[model samples]
Target: MVCGLLRPDAGSVHVTGRPVSTAAGPAKQLIGFVPQDVALYPDLSVRENLRFFGRLYRLPRRRLERRVDEVLDLVDLASRADDRVESLSGGMRRRLNIGAGLVHSPTLLVLDEPTVGVDPQSRHAILESVTRFGEEGMAVLYTTHYMEEAERLCDRVGIIDRGRLIAEGGPRELVQLVAERDRVRLTAVGDLSAYAEACRRLPRVEGVARGGDRGDVVELVVKDARSLLPDLLDLAHQQAVGIRSVEIDEPDLEAVFLHLTGTALRE
Candidate 1:
C-alpha cells in the first residue's frame, strides 16, 4: 500500500506530504522497494542489473554509473560487480538484490524480508548494511517475521497481526506493554502434574502447567525466573521431581507478539 501497488479501501497514504493515490506523484520517486524474493536477471551481471534499475528511474548516464558503483560498494558486492547473478553465491545475490533498490538512492527504502534464505554470514552482512542505512539517515520500512531482527534494527516497531495494527512502540516499550514475565521450562522424569500444582503455589510463579511431549515437563511463568531458581529447585527436590534439564526464556518481542496477536509470531 505504501508503494502504491494496491489502493487502500479507505483513508489515504501520504509519503513526505504527497498523496500516494496519484500515479507518477512525487511520493513514488522517493521509494526504493526490495521484494521478498530476488527480482534480478540471472543472466545479467551485477553492475548490469543495477544499471537497468537506474535507467528505469531515468537517471542520467554519468549519474547512473556513479550510483551503481556506490550502491555496489554499499552492499559490499563491489568485488563481484562483473559477475553474473546466477554465478554469485546466495548471499552475494541477496546483496545485489539490496543494491538494485539503492541504485536511485530513494529517500524511503522498503525492504520485504531481504534476508530470507541467506547464509549466516550473508545475513550478518545484510543486517550491517541495513544498520548503515539508518545511520546515514535513510528512512526504512523493514518487514520481517523475525522478532529478533525487528528488535535489533528498528527504532520504532509497529506490530501488524491479522491485518490490524495491534501495537506500536520501541522494543522496550512494546515488551513492557504486554506485561509478560519470564518463562521457565523444566524437563523432568517424574510426575509433572504434582510438580505443576506445587509450582503454582509458589509466590513468584504466576502460572504453571504441563509442557513438552509425554507430559514429563513443567512450564512456569514467573515474575523473575532467575531470581526464584533456587527456591524452585529446592521445591522440586522436596516434591521428588527428578529434573533432567531446565531452560529459562526471557520475555522479549516474541512474548509481546503472542500477547497482542493471541498466537506465536510464526503462526
Candidate 2:
C-alpha cells in the first residue's frame, strides 16, 4: 500500500505529503522497495542487476553509474560486483537485494524482511547497512518479526497482528509498556500441549506457549514470575510432566509480543 502497488481498503496512504494511491508516480519515485524473496536475474552480474533497477527509475546514465558503485560499496558487495546472482551465497544475495533498492538513492527505503534466510554474518551486515542508511538521512521502513532487530534498528515500531495495528512506540517505550509482566521459561518433558493448556489456568498467568528445539520448552507471561514458580512446578507434576529446569526474565519482548497478538511473532 505504501508502495502504491495496491489500493488501501480504507482511508489513505500519503508519502511526503503526496497520496501514495493517487499520486503513485511521484510518491513511488521517492520510495525503494526490497521484498523478502530474491527478485533478481540469476544470469545477471551483481552490477548488472543494480543497473537494471536504476534504469527502471529512469536515472540518468552518469548518475546511475555513480549510484551503482555507491550502492555496491554500501552493501559490501563491491568485491562481488561481477559475480552472478546464482553464484552468490545466500547472505551475499540478500545484501545485493538491498543494494538494488538503494541504487536509486530513494528518500524512503521499504525493506520487507531483507534478512530472511541469510547467514548470521550476512544478517549482521544487512543490519549495519540499515543503520548507515538512517545516519545518511534516508527514511527506512523495516519489517521483521524479530523484536530484537526492531529494538536495534528502528527508532519507532508499529506491531501489526491479524491485520491490526496493535501497538506503536519506541523500543524502550514499548518495553516499559509491558515492563510489569514477567516471563517464565520451563524445560520439561511429556504431555507438553496438555501441560501448556493446564498452565493457562493458573492465576496471574497471562500467556502460555511452547518453545525450544524439541518443543519441550514452555514459556509463559505472568504477573509475577518469582512467586509463580512453585505453582508451575506443581502443575507440571500433576500433569505428569518432568521439569528439567526453570528460568525467569528470559521472555522479554517476545513474551510481550505473544501476549498482545495472541500468537508468536515469527515467520
Candidate 3:
C-alpha cells in the first residue's frame, strides 16, 4: 500500500509528502519497491537490466550509464555486469532485483522480504547494502520474518498480524516493553505436555509450551530464568525428562511478538 501497488481500503498512502493513492504516477518516482520475488529479464545482461529500468524512469543517457555502474558496485555485482540474469546464481539474481529498483535512486525504498530465498552470503550483502542506503540518506522500509534482521536493521518497526497493525515503535523501545520477562527454551525427551503444564505452575514462569518440529523443546516465558534454573532442573528430573540443552534469552522482538500476538512468528 505504501508503494501504491495496492489501494488502502480506508486511509490514503503517502511517500515523501506526496499522496501515493491519489497521485497518478509521480508519487512513485520518490519510492522504490522490491518485492519478495525477483523481477528482471532472464535474457538481459546485468547492466542491461538496470539500464532498461533507468530508461523507464526517463533518466538521461549519461546519468543512466553512471547509475548502472554505481548500483552494480553497491550490490557487489560489478564483476558480473555482462552476465545474463538466467546465467547468474539465485543469490546474484536477488542482488540485481534490488539494484533494478534502486536505479533511479528513490528517496524511499520498500523491500518486502528481499532475502527470502537467497544464500547466506547474499543475505548478508543485501543487509549491508540496506545499511549503506540508510547511511547515504535513503529511507528504507524493510519487511521480514527474521526477528534478528529487524533487531539489527530497522530504526522503527511496525508489527502486523491478521491484517492489522498491532504495534509500532523503535526496536529497543518495543523490546523494552517486555524487558521484565525472559524467553527460555529447554530441549529434552519426555512427555512434553505434562512437562509444559508443570513448568507453567512454577513461580515467575508466566507461560509455557512445547515447541520445535518434534515437540521436544519446552519453551517458557519467565521473570528471571537464572533464579528458576535449579527448580526447572528438579522438575525435569521428577518428570523423567532427559535434558539435552538449555538456552535463556534476553527479551527481544520475538518475545515482543509472542507477548502481543500469543504465538511465534512463522519462520
State every prediction's TM-score relative to the real structure: 0.80, 0.95, 0.89
Better of 1 and 2 by TM-score: 2
Per-residue CA lDDT of model 2 for 32-145, tens digit only, reads 999989889999999999999999899999999999999888888899999889999888888888889888889999999888778889999889989989999999999998
Question: For model 3, what is the error of residue 5's alpha carbon versus the real structure, in angstroms, after optimal superposition?
Answer: 1.3
Q: Candidate 2, 104: how far from true, in Å?
A: 0.9
lDDT-based ranking: 3, 2, 1
Clashes of each: 0, 0, 0
Lowest-scoring 10 consecutive residues by lDDT in candidate 2? Answer: 258-267
Model 3 ranges off by over 4 Å: 191-215, 227-240
lDDT of 3 at 56: 83
- Runs of candidate 2 exceeding 4 Å displacement: 22-24
Candidate closest to the true structure, highest lDDT:
3
**Residues 1-267, candidate 1, lDDT per residue (tens digit)?**
888888899889877898886477778888898989999999999999999999988899999999998998888888888989999987888888889989999989999998888899999998988999999999999999999999999999999988988889999998886454886778997767777788788886765666565767776667777889998899889888888999988777766775455343543
Write model 3 residue lDDT over 8-55, tens digit each, in one string: 898987776788964457888888879899989999999999999998
Better of 2 and 3 by TM-score: 2
lDDT, residue 16, model 3: 64
- Name the candidate, 1 or 3, with the larger TM-score value: 3
